[model samples]
Target chain A: MCLLWACLLRVSRSTSCFSPVSCSSWAAAARRCNRWVLGVLAAAVAAGTAPGSSVRAAPGPRRITTDGRRKQDLAWSPDGRLLACSLYHTAGQIGVALFDPAGRLVRLLSTDPVEMAPAWSPDGKRLAFVHVTHSGTDGELDIHEMDLEGKTRRPVIEERKAFDMYPSWSPDGRQLLFTTTRDRTQEIYVSRADGTAPRRLTSDPSLKQHPCWSPDGKEIAFNSNRDGNFDIYTLDIEGQNLLRLTRERASDTWPAWSPDGRHIAFVSRRDGNPEVYVLNRDGAGARNLSRAPGFDDCPAWMPDGRTLTWVSDRDGGWDVYVLQP
Target chain B: MLCIGEQRQEWCGGVRRRALVQAGFLGALGLTAPQHAGLCSAVAGRAVILLWLWGGPSHLDLFDPKPDAPSEYRGPYPTLETNVSGMQVTELLPALARRAHQWALVRSLFHQQNDHGIAGTIQMTGRSPQNGRVHPHAGAIVNRLRGNPRLLSGFFVLGDRLQQGHRLIQGEGGGQLGVVYDPLRVTYDPVAGVQLGEVQPPRGVDSARAGRRRSLLDHLAERSPTPTPARDAEALGQMYEKAFSLMTSSEGRRVFELEREPPKVRDAYGRHRFGQSCLLARRLVESGVPFVQVNWSTHVEAEEDAGDGGWDNHYRNFEMLADRQAWPFDQACAALLDDLAQRGLLGTTLVVAVGEFGRTPKINPNAGRDHWPGCYSALLAGGGVRGGQVIGASDARGEAPAAQPHTPEDLCATVLHSAGISRTDVLALGLPVEGEPIHELF
Candidate 1:
């Protein structure tokens, strides 16, 4: 896998400025080389005679707990070791805490007056969260970042009069995408990691919020009220070529792209109480994986593509839960 | 010679009488001052409370019921008789029914915008959104006309500000009229039980400190000296005045204190955010505010599978209508009417309860209704309006107005007029076009 990635990177760089003749020749040579490599690997695996394995298989997600606190919005560290989840409190206070693969609490990341929607940096050195002040004030939200040890707290965006929420780190970790209220209406905005040069991405008069980036960073998925109710939508990084992903009377929100970029998981109220559901990247063959009769939200894909973690209230009070494929 | 002299005197007397008659006629028609001045001045000192139903409430289920409509359209709620012999309100409003004599309910308010954003703009601004124009809200208009000395702000929004799409609802703020004319926005979070957003200082800044800051700012201003626009300056000044008033005036603080009210009274208003908002509106009006708008826009959470909590009941119309939605409104609205009357404010204050538009007359398969802008109902009380009266009617199916349809502009005009503003009070937005207040309601 590493060798293939390296070759693809080299080819992409050469294609950037290659002449038409050179590009065609290079493409042909690459195709022939890929075929030969695949043939040899298949033959060796079939014979069980390979001397050393060159590629590691994708890990299956571990099942943490099924007790039902509706654990959602999982963020894995850059080293792929620790994960963080947004835990909903029945008393209406939202907190963020870290957990290991074995479902053990590792550390408490944030205990703000009100915090939810945690996003980890590409380097996993810092965590960004939507810190809410004064409980129900609409525009009292600010984007905050803190180190993994819950130290060195700093405000990434500090115009305290408008709502700044649902922060998502860019693929390069140099920028962030979040939702903010303009003239009393919610819209998506992208800003630098240091909170400079904020630019609006969507101009619709509907409520646009909960922005999530595709793993490849080519597209962004968000929830909007453009259709008179909440539905999932996607737009390219430049905010063009908008597409609707879900269509029904029920509301769909908090979309998270799978690590492989082939599927998108989201919370929907279509079957009554909100539950975790997944649809293909092309928005086809949609299915509900968490069919339990309880409210579920904030679906996050484990590094191992086969497991999902979410927040649910099935056990009465909100707690984190995991599901396995 | 003596007879001719007498005839000349008689002709002179006749000319004087003719001039007197002409002046009297003009005055009676209100083209002059005396005839209508008393009528307008009667409400000059009184306050006005505007009960803004944020999402459009259903007219058929509340004020304008059509019992003969199909089951899907009518739902399960029945119409009940009010104190007025020939009039009836919905069963959800029994408390209001008993006190029907204290309020005048208009059953035919029509507008073109069915969407919340557009409709809200029209209802608040008194101008159709289709006119491709925006105007100041009715309260702002009142504040501009009736300048007050003791009060910090003439107009106020009691809870969360009105919002739509990515914009605050037009007219909810001072538009072209500038921020000085903007309503004092008091935002509060019920869960936190704390006021959020802008808070003006209650007392004047210490003289020495204020002088020092003023001089420093003024020096900076002189260097820039393009003269910040007048509107911007006015808005800043208004903010300063509001901050001073809020921080200094005991009355202002007391008006916002919900805990000061009798426990039973607070409970009677319900523990919900909107119910408390209504209670606060009454307090503001009583405290000498010229205009108070209570916005019911807070997000109320209930059981996940429960019916509608907000008035935007797109689905499960009957279940929401019977159980969750209408009950709180029924209790609080009825209580408000009674409370206002008991306080003797019903006669002086103009209290209106209305939303942007009405719901669809037809019910969808999910037992919900969509947006309907054709016709709706608005209730008006006090400010010398006659009680026990229903002014308009809907067709048999409650689909559209059968007679006397009132536009949002007319309602705004009525509110302004009740607050002693002449229809000709020009709110100079520096635009070419001029706004004319509605005069028919008075």
Candidate 2:
């Protein structure tokens, strides 16, 4: 059986030269290998040990949990006791929820109707989202703020036809920066926390979205398609200095600064699939921390700064998992 | 005949003997089976041109305006009188109104699904996706039924095929029918004026070289003994033949060449992606293609200070519709209808314009509309359909169908029927669902 397994592996590797005779030989070898593997697995079960543990251990950062829904745009409370996540379902509507540290659903912030890009305030007392509406003749989407109770909702801006989305509140809760289609091009706009006197910040023809502010509130990181494909970019709040952070030929989005302000975690498809990666503030020392087979996205740093929480589908569904740095 | 040997019995009862006797009996009439039955003469020569609104366009604002409705439900645009008395259309669509005598306006098209993915499947396939799984589009069914004879291609889509969340917008192509029935997609950067990167032939490979390559490939295919390889080689030969024909065919080249159009005519259509696509559709129909679908895509990125251009207008309803969206559509569609009429192609070509669903009647605080799947409008012109007619009606608020409510299946059936293809005769390949073409319009 061992010899047959080895022959089957060898034949499988040389599939480019397969012929009728080799095909029959390969079938025989594969059957033997299957039986041998089954036998080893059975023996391991009897011995109370997992088979192929050594082989599986080579891939670092093992999967902890997952759920089927597409999880993205995640955030953690200031104390790191709860994780806020946006759950995307097949119907195109998004549900915002909070989970305990043990991966248990603690609260359901919103559900059913479609919601776009939900963000928690710095104090985690209020949630900001874009409310979508459409008349028989026209349609509109505007920014709305809701308290933790899902009550006391009010519109930040009441301009019809303009699309305001991806609201990110400042750490001091005095100002907010969001992406809006006020000028026909998606540009970043800054407004007071109460949504007063919105000022357009970015003015390029490129598409800008997913704005996240730094810990010190001096620098803002966002994703833009200005350079052809979506990539991570950072700019000062005053719009005086602009910096390109990523240059890979893949979509890099949803940049979140670590609590310590030294590293940034962002989602990228550079490795053939969406995974969470961390790079230095200056875009160096990039490493894939959530390299699961399925999509691993929407990484947020815990307040402790030692562990990161992200949404992954390693368990056949999207769920929150923590990675210790 | 009595106790004949097996070989003799076969020979005596063979079709050749039967044919000889029949020919001898009908010698003076000179009629064969095919001629007698008129089967050869019944070949379909009709074609259909579809104007696909990728994101759902508002029915109330366009075809089924309800001016008497409440202020919020009534859209921003005013209704205009058409050539047909008592018929009204959006004022912006003056061109379509003038040619109202040439087409039928359906106001009560309805479906169950409001989601773009599901609604699109219903509209394109005439049957909703089974178990919510993606299915082949309608153009694919047509392509498979009638193979592209001129090698000019069968199904063609002129925009993005998919929407947000990777949902398959139906009518784009064959989803599971494999690539053979997939529409010859022509993707472009609408804002940047970039054509499809794939359609361009290899650099320096002229028409003569391409023809030579095709002949070589065909010869190799004929000599190959293996069935699989031979089949693959033949398919490749067909592809090359098509590519060569498409590249060298004067009609094909002329159809895609927008620059050759007179400046006044081009300007009349407005300088927008949808307008350009509509113009291209006219060109393709003139080139003898069976099915041409022009998708009005909503993938335009948010523009700074500019209202949302796509149909998924969820925020600023009046400002966007009046200033940006409706004007370009008005001018281009008007020009297309006018052009088709002046060229005498309107009688032979069927033009259909519709979207997945309509928007809600109640206005939100943001002055925008949400998706409404209960009722909508669809416009049909040419191809022998009765003109100057409104088939159905909506309520005062245009909220629901007040008269005859037509399903996407019904509209698809009408399209097929107009193209001289009987819905009952043509069966969808690989789908378990059954469809019968709508006969009411005919």
Q: Write candidate 2's Cα lDDT for B1-442 as tens digits.
A: 2111111212232222212111112111111222223322322345677887656777877788776776557654556778999998865465677778887888888888878777877888777766656566667666666544444346777776556333445545665664456666564333333243234444445556655644554454354444223333344345444444345434333345565666446555644567777877776565556677877663421111121245665554443454346555666677787887787777767888887888887755444577888988888887877779998888888888899878888887777677666644454344554445445554
Interface RMSD of 2: 19.7
> Compared to the true structure, candidate 1 yields what TM-score?
0.50
On residues A129-240, what C-alpha lDDT tens digit does candidate 2 reach at each position? 7665645322356788787666678788666656777788888888888977767656798889999978877887665767888989998999875665567889998886
Off by over 4 Å in 2: A1-325, B1-44, B131-135, B165-171, B175-178, B187-197, B202-236, B244-252, B298-308, B428-440
Provide the TM-score for each candidate, comma-separated.
Answer: 0.50, 0.51
- DockQ for every model comes to 0.01, 0.02
Per-residue error for B310 in candidate 2, Å, reads: 2.6
Cα lDDT for residue B402, candidate 1: 90
Candidate 1, residues B301-364: lDDT per residue as tens digits? Answer: 2112121134666543443454445656766776777777777777778888898888898765
